[model samples]
Each structure stands twice: as C-alpha cells, then as structure tokens.
Target: MPNPSTPEFAVVCRFQGLFPKDIGGYEKHRTRNGGDLGHVDPTRSHLNRPVIGKADWAARTIALIEDMKAENFADEIETLTRRRRKKQIKERMAEGPRDPWRATRHGPMREVILTANRDWFDALPTAAAREARAQAFEDAARDWLLENFGGDVVHARADLDEQAFHIHAVIVPKVQVELNGTKRWMLQPSKHELIKDYEAAQDSVGAHFAPLGLKRGERRAEAVRKARQAGEEPPAYRQHVRTADWRKAEDTRIVETRAELDRRTEAVTAEEVALEQKQEAVTGREKAIGAREDAAMAKEKEAGAVLAVGQGLAAGALDIEDRDGTPALIETPEAKSGLLSKLRARMARSSSGRARALHVFSKALARLREKARDEAKTAVARDTAEIQSADETIVEIASRLPYAERRSIGKIRVSLSARIMALTGRDTSRKTPAKGEDDESP
Candidate 1:
C-alpha cells in the first residue's frame, strides 16, 4: 500500500545478464514447471500462465533459432543450430600458431522482470477479479516488451504463484559480427538501444507503466551519470547479476568479514588483560612506597616532639629532680600541660625505661664531678698567690716595726705559713733574712 501523498504504485524492472551456463538454472527457478521453488504457492501455481508464449525455455529457443535460420542470418545463426549454447574455439599454439589459452568467449543473454509495487490488483473485491487483473497487468507488460524489443523478446510468462503478479521475459540479442577474422553470431544484449545503461532501461519501463498511474522508480545510476557529466573520471561500474547470485556472493563476504573481526577482537582482549596485570603490579609498588613514607613520617614526628621537650627545659618550663636528694616538682604549670604530661608518661612507662634514666643520671653526676675539680684547682692557685704576697710584706714591714712589734708579727706570720701549706698541700713560705740577722741593724 502507498500513502496519499505518493502515487499508489512505483514500477520495478530488473535485468539479469547471463551466459548459457546460467540460463538453465534461472529458467528452472522462474517457471517452477521443472525445478523446485521455495516461495511459490503450489496450490496457486495453476493460476500461473503464459503471458506471451509457452513456459518452456528450450522450445522457445529452438523456435527462435528456426525463425532466424529461415532468414538472411541463416548461416551466421547456424552456430546456434547445434544448440542455443556456446561454440568455443580453443586456440592451440603448441600444435598450431593459435594461442593455447585463447578461446572464443560468448556475450551474455538478458532476462527482464516487469512489475509494479502497487497493491491495486490485490485491492480488487474478489480473488477471481484480482486474478483477472493480474493476468491483464502481465499481458500489458508482455505487449510493452514486444513493442519495445520485437523478436528479441523470445519468451514471457506471468508468475501468479508469487505474492506480486510479475512477468519474466528472456531477450536474446542476436547480432552478426566478425570473430577471429571469420563471420560468426553472438548474443550481445548490450546492442539493445533501450538498455544503453540500467538507468535508460528503467526510464523506459517506468514510462510504460506511467500510463497505469505508477510512478517512476528512483534513479540509482543517476549519480554515476552526473559524475561523468561533471567531467570526472568514470567510476568503475558494477555489473548487475541475478538476485540469487548476488545473495550467495554477499553471504560469503559477510562470513569472511565476521571471521576477521573475531580474530581482531580476541587479540584486543588479550592486550587488555595484559594491560590490567601491569596496572595491578604498578598499584602494588605504589602501596609499598606509601608504607615506607608513613614510617619515615612517624620517625620525623617523634624527633620533633623530643626537640620541643628539650627547648621547654632550656626555657625553665620543665625540670627533673631526684626524689632522694631533691625536693618538689620543678616544672612550671605550662610544662605540665596535657600534651607534655602525656609525653612524660610515655617516656617513663616501664622499669627498663626507669633503669635507663638512672644510668643517664649517673653519667650527668660524673660530669659535675669533673666540673667541680676544675673550679677547686682555680681556687687553690689564687690562695697560694695571696699567701706568698703576705709573707713578703711581713719581711719589709718588720724592719720598720719596734723590736717587740717585730717579734709579735713574726710569730703570726709563721703560723699563717704553716696553715697555707696545710690547705694548699704546697709550701708557701718566702725567705726571711737568714734566721739571726736583724732588720733593725740594717
């Protein structure tokens, strides 16, 4: 069915180029009179009838040959007398001068199918009426073929067994041409002027059906024509083949393509799996690095905390005092804050830590002993110098004193000398005028 905006039908005319090898198979498939068919309704096959001549292709070929035989083309067409098949002349260069691989190749035969996509015939009120219209439609197609193609339109039949009513016609292009420098006959269907190209054939067929109110089909080959018109290089042309052949070729191509795609997909999957394993290995290495960084950070934090505690002690905010030889807590309130208290508690945790602390205290006490000894030696040197100076002064001052005062000062000085020696553990006496010599006589 067609919409209101468009014509209710469009014409469809298809052409299949064939060789003698291909003709028998197509004929069998079309007529269903000799071969099997998949889509034909056998019950309705009786309705199928000849639109131009008989349904037999062989009989039609023979009759056509006889017609040509009776005419001026009788000798040229005698090549087909043996049969409506190829007459190959294989060249034998080894035996003669003819090329061995070279042989006469035949031009192809053409088959045309004429129908429309309109459901007008099927829209008839009754099956009998529909059947009558279908026949009439095919008859019109047959007449059109004969008028346009003449004797070349050898055989046509209406296939009513299919969904659409259509006519199949075989057209032979019998032309006389010089072959191998000898005159011979060939079926060069390209010689038909109506089918100069597919578009031309379609245009003529569409025009014929136009009178029946069917629209022309879209021009598929128009693009190629337009390209040529635009002065571009001609595109490679795709020759049309029978639908069955096209289907078979396409099926094989699709199967090969799918197999190639499957191989590529498997390769991609393997690569992806390898990439995932590599990523996992990289992730493991990253985790190991993170753990090492965490340990380093912990050590740094502990060192920072210990440094802060030492700074606090220098600021007099914290102190340590031995319980046996010292009095009270020496830390300021600032030093006993929650953070420092926690640090102190952590540091003083076990008996082992206490023992370590005691050993450290003993080392500090020994340092103090060395410091005290240095101070004591400085004091003893100062005292010894003072005592010597006093002894020398006594000798000078006694000479200026009275006899009595001299005797008294002498006794006191002697006592001082003995005490200086005892305290310093060294002699401190200075020389007195020989023992008996009087400073007063001098």
Candidate 2:
C-alpha cells in the first residue's frame, strides 16, 4: 500500500502576561486553576491558568493542566484552548472499509493552529473580548493558511493552553503539495518547523486587528468607501469594513423620524383641543335653545291664565272674530261662570227689562261691536291721515319681526277690516275717505 497523502494544516500561537509571585491570592489562584481564565476577580481565589502547546495533544493533555479534568472541563477550558483538527481520525477508524480504495485520510482530515502574544490577551475587554480575540485569531489564521498552504481553510475548534489561544482548522486542498514529483505527507510536518513557518506567516498580516474590532455595519461602509476610492468593483472584504457614512445616514434617519413624530404629536394635540372647543360651543347652543323654549312655554301659560281672567268680558263678543284666530266667547269653565254672573247683575238692575238680560247684552255687544268697527276705521284713518309719520314707524317695527310673523299680522288686519264691513252691512269701498283726501289742498 502507498503511504497516505499528508493532511494540509495551519498553526497559530498565543501568549498571556503574568504578575510577580508576591501578589498573594493572585499567584495561588493562578496556580490552582491555570491561567485560562484571566485575573478579573480576587475573591474567587482561582482564576483558570492555561497549559502550553496542547494544540495536537489536547485530548490527553487536558488532564495535565493545573486543575482536575472535571473542573477544567467544567470551565470549558478544553473548548476554549483546543485547536481545530479539520478531520476526525477516530471516526475514520470506526467505519471498517467495505472497499479498500474508498478508505483514505486525504478526503477530510483538515486541521490548523494559531498563536498570539499576551498583549493581545490583555487587550481583550472581558470574556466577550476573549471570544472576539479568539474569532479574530481564527479568521487571520485561516486567511494565512489559504494564502500560504494553497487550500481552502476553515476553523473547526479552539483551545487555550497556558499563554496561547490556539485553533484547529480543516483544509480541503485544491492542488496537492508536490514533493519532488510526489505527494507530501499531510500530518508528517516536524512540530518545531511548523511553529516557525506559522509565526512568519502571521507577522505578514497584522493590519486586520482594528477592522475586526469595528461593528459589522461600520465595516461594510468602510469597504464601500475604499471601493469608491480604488475606482473598482467592491471586493468581498468590503462587506467587513465599518465606515462613518453608514452611521451618519442612520443618525439622520433617526433625527428625521423623531421630528416627524413630534410634529404628528402636536397636530394630534391641536385636533383634540379643537374638538373640545367645538363640543363646548355645541353645549352652549343647546342650552340657549332650551332657554328660548322654556320662555315660549312660560308665555303660553301666562296667556292661558290671562284668557281665563278676561274671557267672560269678551264672551258676548263671541259671535265676533278678533284679529287673532281666537274666538271672543269664553271656551273654558272659569270664563263661563264669569259671563253668567255678569248677565245676572244686568238682569237685577233693569226693572222692566229684567227678564231680557240676554237681549240687552246682545244689543250692547252689537253697539260695542259697531263702535269698535268705527273706532278701527278711525284708527286706520288716523294712520292713513298721518301715513308719512306712521309709515317709517310701521316699517321699522315690522322689520324687527321675522318675515313670517309680519305677513301673519298683515293678513289678520286685512281680515278684521273685511269682517267688520260684512257685520255692519256697509259697502267697504265707500266707508272710508280716499287716501289723499286727508292730504288734499281743497
């Protein structure tokens, strides 16, 4: 059988700073837990300490760290410190080959590793910072691997050991490394030589740190600006650069939205106030209408009372129609009693005509009716005689009434004059002097 082709891999290195031993609790904690967890807490006593160079040997090397396996695993130090081995070797061992040609490590055993200085570790903010630093290291490490190792590289896992944050990556080689016209062994690189080559590659790409710290949106905008500057189509990395223009646009949008919200709020407030005022106005109008209706009802009641009082006096005149639509005769019981009492008085006073009280009353009413007719004629004559004086007064007073009321009064006055003429058996045409006769020069 031919020697198996070597698995392509990248290596990473990391470091952490240490304080002097006289620090009391710090040293003890460091010794107890190993330095994987940095010295952020003093009371906790044990900050995790990391082990060195466990990238390849992490499965077995975990037991050799400062704490027991359970405590170390409890803190997830293995996950944090282990480098990604792109392929699972144990899984390969599990599946017994059905066909001898198909069983080869060349297919999937990709792996990579990374290393960094203690300054980088201290530069991290907190646990979150540590995570970000790890990710950055992976990304940088992968890029280096692809550029130098000539295969697509992806980080599979990470582990922290002693001072270094290390990663394991998988590589799917596009073109195999040619060693004097033969495939080189993938997993056979000398450990010392691998570290040296990895360091040299990492030093070549140092500018990505600040950009990595930026927010994703900022990174994208920076990429756009760079693309514009270069006068070329934006590269895929443009999506990673954060720039100021995007943030400025976002701020402008926020400010505009706030202003619009304030303006709408003001408009809504104004509308509410206006609606309240309208409601108040409607309430006032309703109250005024109610008052007018109340006054009209009161007037009707007073008129009814007055009609009860004077109705008897005008009873004999019942046969007559007044200017208003009401009859002169008393229509109510109170008015009837009054008319009968007056009739009795007239009968008591007249000796010979005692029994003819009704006739007397009839005669009196007839005379009074005639006199009223004459008086009405004279009143009309007087008004006609002084037409110039009355005209303005009538017009002004009539104008004060509504048009319908004014028309009603005119109709009543005309009907009354016509009725009086018919009762007196007089010709209406000749009863009154002509209009200009009162003003004649004769």
Candidate 3:
C-alpha cells in the first residue's frame, strides 16, 4: 500500500476519438447521466463543489463545419456551387449551397483528459488547497491544447467528482486550406494531428507538468524490455508508470544536478577572468621595470663617456681649450722628432756619411709626420663619435622621462660638469683665460 503522506507522481494525457456515433454517449458521461458513479467518492468529494465547470451539449456540430469552410475556402466554395432558377421563366439565379461535412467519416471531435495520480491530491492537507491545484492544472492543460492543436475547442470542463481531479476538453480537428487565392478551413476526420503518436504526446505532457512535480509514466515497451533483461516474469500491466511521489523526487534530483553544473560553470568562468587580470598586471609591472632599467643603463654609459674624456685630458693626451668646447688631441713626444732633429743628429757625421744619413733621416721624418697627422685625425674622430653617442643617449633618456623627471635635465648637466672637473683635478669655477687669449702674470 502507498503511504498517505507521500505524494504519487503521474502526469496523464489521454486522447479519445469522438466519432458521430460516440458523441451522444460521451456527452451523457460528461453530464453524469449515464450512471457511471465509479469516479465519485462521497467521502473524498468536497462540499458544494461543482461536478462540471463547463458544458455545451446543444452546440450545432454541423454548423461549426460549415462556418469553418466558409471562412477558409471562400474561393473554392464559389467554384463548387452552381446557379439555379426557381422557375423556367424566372430571371433570378441563386447559388446552390456547398456541403463539406458529408466527407467526414471518423474523427469529428477529440476528447483529451489531463489528470494526475490520486495520491497527489491525497497528500494535500486541505480541500481548498487541492481545489486550487486542480484548477491550475486544468487551466494549463487547456492552454496547451489551444497552442498545439490548431482546431476549435468547443467545450472544456474540470471534473471534481472523478476518482482523480481531471480536465476534459473537446476539440474539432480542423486544418486551414488555401485554394484559388481564397482561404478555407476543413475538418480532418481520418487523422488527428495532435494525438497521432501516443508516446510522443505523453512525452510532451510530461515536459509540460515537470515543473509542477508531475512526470510521464513509463512506456509499455520499456517495461517489457526491462522485464526481459531482468529474467523475471512480466507484470500483467504492460506499462510501468511511476507514482507521484517517485516523480517528484526524481524532478528534485534533476533540478539539483542542473543547479550544481551551473554553479561550477560560473566558478570556472570567474577563475579564468581573474587569471587573465593577474597576467595583465604582471606584464604591466615587467614593462615598467624594463623601462627603468633601460634609463639607468643609459645614464651609466653617459657617465663612463665623461670619465673617459676627463682621463684623456688629465693624461695630457688631449687639450680641452677647443673653440666648440670639444677636446682636441695634441702632438705627442714621438712626433716632436721631425726633420730638424734628424738634421742636427746627422751634422756630426763625415761628409759622405752625413749626406747618406740626411737622405735616410728625411724619408723617415716624412713618414713620421704623415703617421702623426693620421693618428691625430683618428683620435679626434673617435672622441667626437663618443661625445655624440653620449649626447644622443642623454636626449633619448630625456624624451622618455616623465614630466617631473625631465625638469632635472639641467641638474644632470651640472652634475656631469662637476664630475668632469673633479676627475681632471681642475677648478673650472675659477676665471680662466679664454681660447686664443694670453694669461698675464700678476
């Protein structure tokens, strides 16, 4: 026996074909006049509850077919009609009526019942709560019918007197027709499009009620297959429908699984974003450090160039009194031994030896002069290149420096001058003789 506290889960969507002969019998059952009180339980039925919410037994079914045709097949209707005269001499002609209802042989209407397991209602604590739930389910079922089935829903009612609260809706299966540029509608008797596949319909109904904690029952084929796999005797009932309680539990599990997956996905996405941000920050810091290092290296090179120039001047290998403030290489001690020194050395020799020595010394003096001139030019060129390189480095550093740092360029120049003076042991701040000016002894 099922527990009273536990709700049974079952979403039932069953369709019954309504032929011309079956309409009267179905109407009688809907009206509760056929003596089928099996659905009614006096102990369970709520007081003052209406048995049927809607009814329309006197509705003209044939007129509904004609109206559908007139609306959808106006052009085809004219083609099917013929002109007729009341008398041979009468001038008036009237169009004969077209009858499309004669063709329907099978399904004139469809009865769809939407219900849930009895245990679902039994689990509800109060009669009012059960009534509300049943009403909501009925409304949803009616909406589903109108959305999926393109037909006339003539009647709909909720049967609270039944074993389980259920909705019964009557639908006329009609299709729109277009012929000769005119719209027409016709009733489909052979095939009801909505309930063509019973299994597919059940699946759809299950999905519709899944949010409400009601799911489809198991299929007969699946139950048979499972029974064969288990090597057990098949149950008498081919279908293995789950109870309302079981369906509700399964739905809860599915919902929780989906929620967990979504949370994990969100977490992974957030982590990726954070990682990208961290990488970008690291890259920015590295670039900043690289720029600072480059500036420091350039300053070091500039200082080295200044120190080299100062060393050359202190060694007397270069003079710093040039017009453009650039250092110039001076004559070395070796270059001072020119033609005059050679002639003086040769003067003490015998006439023939002196003449021969003079000739050799003259050639040697010429080569020495040429070599000295080339050496002075090379040294000047090298010093000029080094100075220009240092100047370019300073300019580049200044351009890359921030606005606040750029203001220190003048201070940097002053520092460079002080460094040069300190290395050369010169007091450059004291007054000194200008280029080409003589220094008077006081």
Best by TM-score: 1
Q: Per-model C-alpha lDDT, please?
A: 0.65, 0.44, 0.59
Better of 1 and 2 by TM-score: 1
Model 2 over residues 224-330: C-alpha lDDT tens digits?
A: 67888999777564221111334556678999999999999999999999999999999999999999998786665544433433344456422333436333333
Q: Which predicted model would earn the best lDDT?
A: 1
lDDT of 3 by residue, 350-392 (tens): 3443334334444554577789999977876676567546755
Expressed as tens digits, the lDDT of each residue in 1-442 for candidate 1 is 5468643677888876655555667667765755445557888888777766555665667555455434424342454444443433122212222211113343356778888764766777898888777766776697789887887777788887876888888887787667534454555666787755778777887788766667777765786678789998766776666556666778789999999999999999999999999999999989889988986765555555544444445565655555776422345776547656655664444434434444454456557767899998999889878876776766777768778887888777767677878888875555455334465422
TM-score of each: 0.46, 0.22, 0.39
Better of 2 and 3 by TM-score: 3
Q: Against the hidden true structure, what lDDT does model 2 obtain?
A: 0.44
| Higher-TM-score candidate of 1 and 3 | 1
By summed lDDT, the worst window of 10 consecutive residues in model 1 runs over: 93-102
Q: After superposition, how far is residue 30 of candidate 1 from its true place, in Å?
A: 3.1
